[model samples]
Target: MENLNRSMKLSLEFGLSGAVLLPVIYEVYANISTSIGLFLVAAFACFAGVKFSALKFREAFVGITCTIAYSGILGWVCYLFIHPRVVDMLLKRSVYFSLDIRQQLYFLLYCFIILACIYLIWLVRFGLHKAMEKFKSNSEKTGSYIENAFDDGKDDENL
Candidate 1:
């Protein structure tokens, strides 16, 4: 039930998620010098979290979980599909042990997909919440708690 439909909240979530997972991915899977990017993203996440209205901690928790889960899954997939190529690339005794252009692009694509999945998960949650809100609001607006289903214009003097 996060208000992740808002742009600011979504951005904050993305920043925080990226800041957390990018460094981990760099250490675990590939080395891409994410320190500066992590710092910037984390700083923005902090700023946004401070400037915006505070949501329940569950929102942050869920976002972190989503990011971690997505990253973990992506990691395994990459390990299966891309790690072999990277290992082969590195074992070639080239001047640079870094990833090739295609490898770099694949790594970037994986990172982007993880972050995007986090947003997509939260978007689905927000959509469901909005739909329930609309349903509840429609009922509340169209109905009343009063016992009377119909009322005459005249006030009963006999009461």
Candidate 2:
């Protein structure tokens, strides 16, 4: 039950983050390519997922997946409905392009790569944290040994 609740919370966090950020980012960079804008949206979604989940890798992954799914749905809706109207209003002209299968594939590929990179970064950070812990422990041991040696030398001199 607790796990279910946690998952739901994470999913909502991801979905909302993706949904809200996508439009804002597109509005800000109106002239940018769709792919670049989506990439930025994905990056922010990932960041928000990780941040809001208390930096838990598994939870962040769940969040990211939810974010992508929600964003895709919202994007499709916008493309089908909101986009044409906005374009018509702004340009007073209609533009049409045939669907390019390659572009769709490339977009998916890029999204996969971005997600993979984020996970890799998390792994590296975890590794560095472990390494720092080991180094700190070794340094403490060395410090204690040096202090013990100094104490022994003082004892010998007093004797």
Candidate 3:
């Protein structure tokens, strides 16, 4: 029952996002390339996230598959509505193409660095959880031993 509710909520959220993106995606994709390469890269990012979230193989694959389908469908819709004229104008006016390639590459490198920082945060969270688990296990063992020792001492006193 809890699983059903969670699934329903996720469905609603995704549906709402899709509906909202349908209209705004054109604006987002205007500067971004419409190439298959970009789409695949986005899909891969989603897949990596899904894999990280889902520990089991089946669950991970299911998430990746769903994400790929959603990404493609959403991207297609965004592409269809994108304002190409505005994008073309921006591209013509921008110094990106005229600027040093090294600078552009450095900018992309910084973007990846930011993403790596976010990944590090997740790693820290995972480490904290493992530490907590280890602490809890050790405490439980200590508790059991103390209880047994007390029981033995009580028996000796009573004797």
Clashes of each: 0, 0, 0
Please give the lDDT score for candidate 3.
0.45
What lDDT score belongs to each candidate, Candidate 1 first?
0.50, 0.58, 0.45
lDDT tens readout by residue for model 2, 31-122: 44675767685676457544434445565566556656776576565556555555565466433332367755655566556644545555
Arranged by TM-score, best first? 2, 3, 1
Give the per-residue lDDT digits (tens) of candidate 1, residues 63-142. 44554455445556555655555556656854324567886576566555544444444455556667898999988866
Candidate 3's C-alpha runs over 4 A off are: 11-65, 83-135, 150-152
For model 2, the run of ten residues with the poorest summed lDDT = 90-99
Q: Please say which candidate is ahead in lDDT: 1 or 3.
A: 1
True-structure lDDT of candidate 1: 0.50
Candidate 1's error at 154, in angstroms? 7.6
After superposing candidate 1 on the true structure, give the runs of residues whose Cα lies further than 4 Å from its correct spot.
1-17, 31-99, 142-147, 150-159
Per-residue CA lDDT of model 3 for 46-136, tens digit only, reads 4344334423333433433443345346545554555454456667887222225674454334334432332344345456667898999
Best by TM-score: 2
TM-score of each candidate structure, all chains considered together: 0.38, 0.59, 0.42
